[model samples]
Target: MLYIFQDETTSTVAPARLYKALTIDGDTIIPKVIPGFRTVEIVEGNGGPGTIKKLTFEEGQHIYVTYALHIYNL
Candidate 1:
């Protein structure tokens, strides 16, 4: 469960790698960082925009997964 609602911004040790955080392959960091999630795998689409990602977690019983589509600027 999420705790208090607070605003925060953190500086990263790797600035160049930070940009990849929003990219397709960069998304693996989410499930790796976030709790409850066992593994974050790419389900469909290529790599950039419209890529659908499947997230498996312990909280949701692993039966159903949330889908996220990559949105690219260019």
Candidate 2:
């Protein structure tokens, strides 16, 4: 089975800051912002275009893995 989640938001903040928070500081920020996951790990790339992230839910040993792909600028 496969599940997909997508989110899009517009912010008044600087793009660089938002990028840093999403990529650089993401591992640290995720748990605090979304409390259900037991752990979050950057198992692959460093939040780059081909990066991968894993979220673990210990209750059922469920894992959700995701990767990023670079898309042309809007």
Candidate 3:
């Protein structure tokens, strides 16, 4: 049998912007960093669980991940 592992990390920054080279446009930031990511797409939802995101890369790589939203009243 084989086993798979997954991890998550969260970083916080001001709601400010990054730069023209690294625009804060939606969530498609692959091509900005690599400049050859080809394409990245996201399925929009009103911010909730069960949302799906799809990504495609120039190196023939693809991935699908589901978004789970967590909310807290600070």
RMSD of each: 5.8, 3.5, 6.9
lDDT of 3 by residue, 1-74 (tens): 33444456554644355433233354556655665466545476543454444445566455433443343455
TM-score, every prediction: 0.56, 0.58, 0.36
Off by over 4 Å in 1: 1-15, 22-27, 70-74
Q: Score residue 15 of candidate 1 by CA lDDT.
A: 57
lDDT of each: 0.64, 0.72, 0.48
- Give the distance in Å from residue 14's predicted Cα in candidate 3 to where it truly belongs: 6.8
What digit string (tens of lDDT, one per residue) describes model 1 on residues 1-74? 32333356788548567666746445577767777777767788776566667777776574647465544355
Angstrom error of the Cα, residue 64, model 3: value is 6.1
Give the candidate order by descending lDDT.
2, 1, 3
Candidate 3, position 49, lDDT:
50
Of 2 and 3, the candidate ranking higher by lDDT? 2
Score candidate 1 by lDDT. 0.64
The residue-level lDDT of candidate 3 at 72 comes to 41
Which residue pairs of candidate 1 clash? Answer: none
- Cα error, residue 4 of model 3, in Å, equals 15
For lDDT, the strongest prediction is 2
